[model samples]
Target: MDLDTGVALSRHDDHVDPFPVRRAEPAHAVPAGRMGYDLGAERLLLHTVQSAEAFESLLTTGTLRPDPELAEEAFTDAYEWIHRMMAARLPTRGEGALWFWARTRRKHLVDTCRRSRGRVLLTCRVPRERVLLSHFDEWHLVLNKGLGMPRLPGESEDDAFARWEEEHDDFDARLRAAGMRDAPVRDWPADLRTEIEKSWESIFDRGNYGPFECWQGTTHALNNDEVLEAVRII
Candidate 1:
C-alpha cells in the first residue's frame, strides 16, 4: 500500500549511545503556513457543556481556584509527566511528528509559566482534532492533537517503528513506480516544487501533507504536555 503523503517519516538508529543529553530550548515560534480549522456547532456545544461541568464541579466543592502560581506548577508538572509517559510508548503510528513538536514546544511553555508568575489563561480545543486537551500560553497555544490511527494493545516501540518503516518503504516503492523518484532530494518537476516554494500555504496544499490541525492560542498558557500530546496523536 502506498504511504499517505501526510505520513512521511525518517528513521533513527536504536543502537545509538544512551543518555544523549542536550541543552533545553524553548519553543520559539508558531509553525508558519499551517492551516487552522473551525469547529462545527455540535463540537462547540459539547465542549461548552464539558467546560461548564468542570467549572461546576469546582464550585460545588467550594474549591478555590489555585493562585496562578500553583496552577502553573500543577499544569507544568502534569504536562511534563504526560509527555514522558507518551514517549515511553514510542513509534506508535503518529509519534514522530506529534512528539517532535511537543518536545520543542514544552520547553517554551514551561518557561513561560515559570516566569509569568502564574498569570496565564487556559482554554481547550474542540475534539475534532482528537486532542484530549489544549491551552493558550502568552504567545502560542499547545494542543493535544491525537492521531486517527489506533494503537493495538501490547505493541512495543521497536515493533511499531519496524512496521512504520516497512510501510514507509512500501510507499516509496509506489512513488518510484509512479516515476516520482527522479529527485527525492531535489526539485524534479518544476511545477510542483515551484508551487511549494511560492508560499507556505501552497507547500501544505501541494507539497507533503501531514496529519495535524492548527491549534491556535496564546503561547504562554499552552502547557508542554498538552502540545506534545497533540503532536503524538497527529
Candidate 2:
C-alpha cells in the first residue's frame, strides 16, 4: 500500500475493495503503551473539518499534508507545541500529522466553519495502525504545559496547583506556579521538559479528564482514496 496516498499499489484483478475489510468489532478500549490500533482488527471512522482550500488540495494532490500557513496564521505557537509533543510520543505518525475527531460534534464543526469561512467535513475509514487516538481535553494540557498531575475529586484549581507544587522540586514548582503564560516549555529545564513530554503520552488513554470530551485522533496524512465522504459546510 502507498503510505502517502493510502491506496493499494498492486492490482490483483480489475475489482478492488473500496474500504478496508472489517475484521471484527471495534475494541472497547485502547491498551496501555500502544497509541495506535496496531494490535486490533478495527478500523476507525474518523471525521475532520478543513477549509475549502484544503479540500481542493486533497482533490488535486490525492493527499493532504499539514498546512503550515494555516497553523502559523491561526494556531500560532500552540500548533508547534502540540506537534512537538506528538513527535516525541507518537514518532511514526508525528510529522505533518492531521487532526480528526473520532466522534463528530456539531458544535466543533460549526465553530470551525465560522472561523475558516468555507469549510468541509471529511469522513474516512482509517486503519487503527494509521491513527493515534487521544483525549481532546488532556491535549490542551500538553499544549499549555499545564499540570498533568491528577487532581483529587474535590480539589479546586488553586488546590491542585498547590498540591502539585508540594510534590515536585523547587524548579518544577516554580514553573508550574509561573504557568505557561509567563514561562513556556521552551525555557524549562531539559529534564523537566522530558518529564512533561512523557506525561503527555497519557493523552491517548481515552479516559475522561474534568468535563472535556475525549474524541481526538491524529494521522500522518490522509489521501483522496481514504476519504469515504466529504460534505461542504459553509
Candidate 3:
C-alpha cells in the first residue's frame, strides 16, 4: 500500500509473510560474521522524515529521541498510551520511541517529505525485537478514545456498545447522554479498559486487519551509527 496515496499494491495469491527476510551487515562496531549468526531474524529496513533542526541534533548528539514538545496535546497523550503499550507488548531497548514506516514505498517517502517539509530522510536497520508494528487505520480508535471491540455477527458498533453497556451500567452511554465528551481511558471500567488493551494487541497482527497496507513501527532511540542512510530530501 502507498502510505501517501492510499493505493493498494499488488499481492500474490499466496499468504503474505509479515516479516521481511533480507539480511544485512549489522550496524557499526559489530564483529564481522557475528550478525548473520547472532541476529537470527532479519532486521527491519525503515524510513522516517525529520526537520533539518532534528537532523542536526541527531548528528550532534549521536542519537535521536522523540520530541514531545513538537507533538500536539492529543498526540502527546496518544504517544503516552503507545509507549505504555510498547513496554508491555514489546521488548523495548531504550527510553521513548521514534516512529517509522515499515516496508514502505518510495512515493510514500517522497510524499511524506513534501507534506512535512522534511529535509532529511533517515533509513535505518533495526532489530525486530525493538519494534512494534501497528495498522495505521485502526490506530484512530486509540487516538479518538473509541472502543475497539469486534462486533458480533450482524451487530453494528452501536448495537455492540448497547449490549456491552448493559453489563457495565452503561457508563459510557451515560456520559454521552450527559453531553460529556472525551472520557479518558483511565476512567473507564477496569474490565473494559482491559478489553481495550487486549484489542490494541491486534495492531501488531497485520493479518487481523486484513489487507491494510500502512503499518507503522515504533522503536527506541536510534544512534547515528545505526542509520544506514540519511538523504537530504529538500
Each prediction's whole-model lDDT (CA): 0.28, 0.60, 0.61
Residue by residue across 112-228, what tens digits does model 1's lDDT show?
434433121122232233322221221121111111121235777578557746754664565566576544323335543333223222211211222343222111122222211
User: Which scores higher on lDDT, 1 or 3?
Assistant: 3
- For model 3 the local lDDT of residue 105 reads 43
Please give the TM-score that candidate 3 achieves against the real structure. Answer: 0.66
Error of 1 at 100 (Å): 16
Summed backbone clashes in each candidate are 22, 0, 0
Off by over 4 Å in 3: 1-41, 93-95, 149-181
The residue pairs found clashing in candidate 3 are none
Clashes of 1: 22
- Candidate 3: tens digits of C-alpha lDDT, residues 139-229: 7767765555544666776997787556434546655654543656666556666766666666666555434366778877776766775
- 63: Cα error in model 3, Å: 1.5
TM agreement with the true structure for every prediction: 0.23, 0.63, 0.66
Output the lDDT of residue 161, model 2. Answer: 77
lDDT of 2 at 207: 37
In the range 60-98, model 2's lDDT, one tens digit per residue, is 677888865555433344566667656765546535569
